[model samples]
Target: MSAANRSGADNQPGVLVTGASGFVGRYLLRRLQTEPVTVSTLQRPRHDLLQPASLTELCQGVDTVYHLAAYAHVNQAQIKTLYATNVDGTINLLSAAVAAGVRRLVYVSSILADPAFDQPRTAYGEAKQRAESLLQAAHQAGDIEVVIVRPVNVYGVGMKGNLMTLLRLLRKGVMPPLPRFTQPFSLIGVEDLCQALVLAAQCSVGDNAPIYALTDGEHYDIKSLEQAMRTALGRSQPAWATPKAVFYLGALTLEIAGRLLPINNSPGLRSYHALARNYAVDDTASQRDLGYNPRSTFYCTLPAIISAMDAGSAGADTSDTDNTQ
Candidate 1:
């Protein structure tokens, strides 16, 4: 990534972004350009997983620093790593920002900090909450303008999370057996989330007075969301509503086996637990304060994604068509 410099008279601030390679980071980086702000990214070195010193130097003279980097794997074994990256790393970054006289520290937290879940029981949620507390403490002590933004169940193109796995299953015509969750779950497109972040970075209304929870306008239950996906794909598939007890048992078994075996941890399981108990948020504050207007809902966007996937599959099928008859 090339650095694009701006004159001091431009009025836009120099912004530093951590987790520049992550799903949300990519969108935020692209969206920041439209605001005509000077953007710089921080990436960990190939061998060095932790780079607090490097982050410090990067924040020097920057007006706002957006901390998005974290060891996001949500499992028991990954607990230490998550704390190191999400908690310790945040502390390091905040210390550096304060030293460098950075104006604002916009933290991209998760909805897991909502207290809606028993965060103590979940490793990932607990880590996020811890990080939030650290930032809030820093804010209270007058270290920096720490603005926390909590987003729920973000999904879009190039998404590498649970939603992508579900989409992949749909592509393969396998309707995933889901839990019978009747909660009004919220979501925001990656694009809209980026917009909110930029607005948060530039906002001077609160002086860290409020912590915002962000979401798209529409909320859907698991059953309805699955049906929407099926309708989008124009396919009919049977989906089983696995009992919650059975589902948790399977997740527990997998969690145990994932340690002994070489299986990758599934964020889907954690998300399922969160949804099974309802994880909705009130984003009205973000909308009013940060000018955060969510884009199209799952019902609107899922169809487009499915239609594009279908078109791609159809094109691939006809790629070998012969005209030499």
Candidate 2:
């Protein structure tokens, strides 16, 4: 067996990291290495959830599974692919882990599962909600020991999606064309999320308190974020607030345009959701249960992320694959 496949090591009390090549997964893999635990990653082809082969070989002796794989992008055009990967794929993982006698499973979900939001719903949210429901049912049925963590926008270096777009806008001494609004955004750093995952897997929390919302414990104010980005870039750009209607109209127009064309990379009109809803997650449960104390506030983390981006830009060419889901 390859060294990476050693993660689901015969109930060796280590972690099996799915989506290890993605942004948060990369950070999680690195963070797990610092701890006194064996780490294994699920490889592609035969182990892929969509693949026909069973997960027997890959999950043979794994004790715990950190499931981070899914169609993370909110604007993916192929609706069928989204459900296939997120829903069916989750079943595949859960069933295989059960067959392998895994002790615990950590399913990473997104806060966008909030159904009350008025924004045009995306398939990504539907997919995650389905996955959560399946896992919850399995846990209740005594089929799997499952823990669910719903995180807000996760930020980290070398990450992709809207976060990167905002960073690029700031790097050029410009703020994102965001409207003036008061909806609070909940965000978490990749490092802190990894910590939360491990804690959720190993903590002595009861089954009733399994679902926890992950955040940095600070309310995200877009206007404040604008100022922080400017400060980080060392630019004295005058901060002017755009009217909410402008943002609304622009988003509506894009939403219409996206339907008419192939809006692949950025989620055109879906960007409005970032400006429209209250994404502030009550992290009291996470703090009380998992001891997930994030010391990095938006202001502090922004500067550090900006500095790291600057250094990376100087050393080598880099790209961020953005996902706001």
Candidate 3:
């Protein structure tokens, strides 16, 4: 928790970060330190979104708010908790921000929020979508200026989620080789995402409150991505590719096991869909509007991710890890 200058000849703009302890939030905090703005972090139980009174106190004197905290678990079992935290929590936080006179809110939304995605919506995605609508409504009503950023699959050092699962399996040498899937998948490095977030905070928006999709501007297929990870991990490429049926069967077993036991975030059809589908994004608006130029590609960042995983930092309680389901 950092303090803002209450009174100064030139009042440095006050910035508050909601998910200060999450994956992207951690990188964002580091990025903000280099900027001129004074930064403040949410104090957990004291500043929880569900607790509106705490949020109101936290937002006082804050000019910009980065709303990153949310229940990101993709498991269906957590649907009730997801809505309570992601949707209702967002509503509570938005009200507090408005009441406290916060000038702008830069929301780190997910690409899943776009209804255009072909895959079935996860509980996590629906929650994010609902929260985005509330923020848009607030912006339209002139309560606060809003900039919504829908980031593609974010990857970097210490990243969790699907990629982390893949890495761990690959490290153990028990994972089968991936099939040749040509569908493109878009990914943005965490550092690049943080840069785009800061840029979003500074850029002006229209009355409609523009939404930006961010990517690393690199095209990747399942095979290429897996090969790159294997290379980074110093593993030899498998001569044979595992059939899609085997992958699906394994996922189904995990799904059943998850239901029977206490497994959260079991690999099921959703994981298969994510792995096989073309979950790409267009960042032309982001480039034109916010001057967002992503510098790191998945191929380039694999070494760092491998390094972090080797050091046993992958499954930490960061943003991606917390919502890895």
* lDDT to native, each model: 0.67, 0.72, 0.80
lDDT per residue for candidate 1 within 182-218, as digits (tens), equals 8776777878788888888877644343688878877
TM per candidate comes to 0.83, 0.89, 0.92
Please write out the lDDT profile of model 3 over residues 91-174, one tens digit for every residue.
998898899999999998888887666365677777788888999999999999999998887888867777778888998898
Which 10 residues in a row give candidate 2 its minimum summed lDDT?
A: 314-323
Which one wins by TM-score: 2 or 3?
3
* Top-down TM-score ranking: 3, 2, 1
The number of the candidate with the highest lDDT is: 3
Better of 1 and 3 by lDDT: 3
Superposed model 1: Cα runs more than 4 Å off: 1-12, 46-49, 118-120, 176-180, 205-209, 237-249, 259-262, 267-272, 307-325
Better of 1 and 3 by TM-score: 3
User: Which candidate should be chosen as best, given TM-score against the real structure?
Assistant: 3
Q: Which residues of candidate 2, in runs, are more than 4 Å off?
A: 1-4, 7-11, 52-54, 74-76, 173-177, 205-209, 313-325
CA lDDT for candidate 3:
0.80
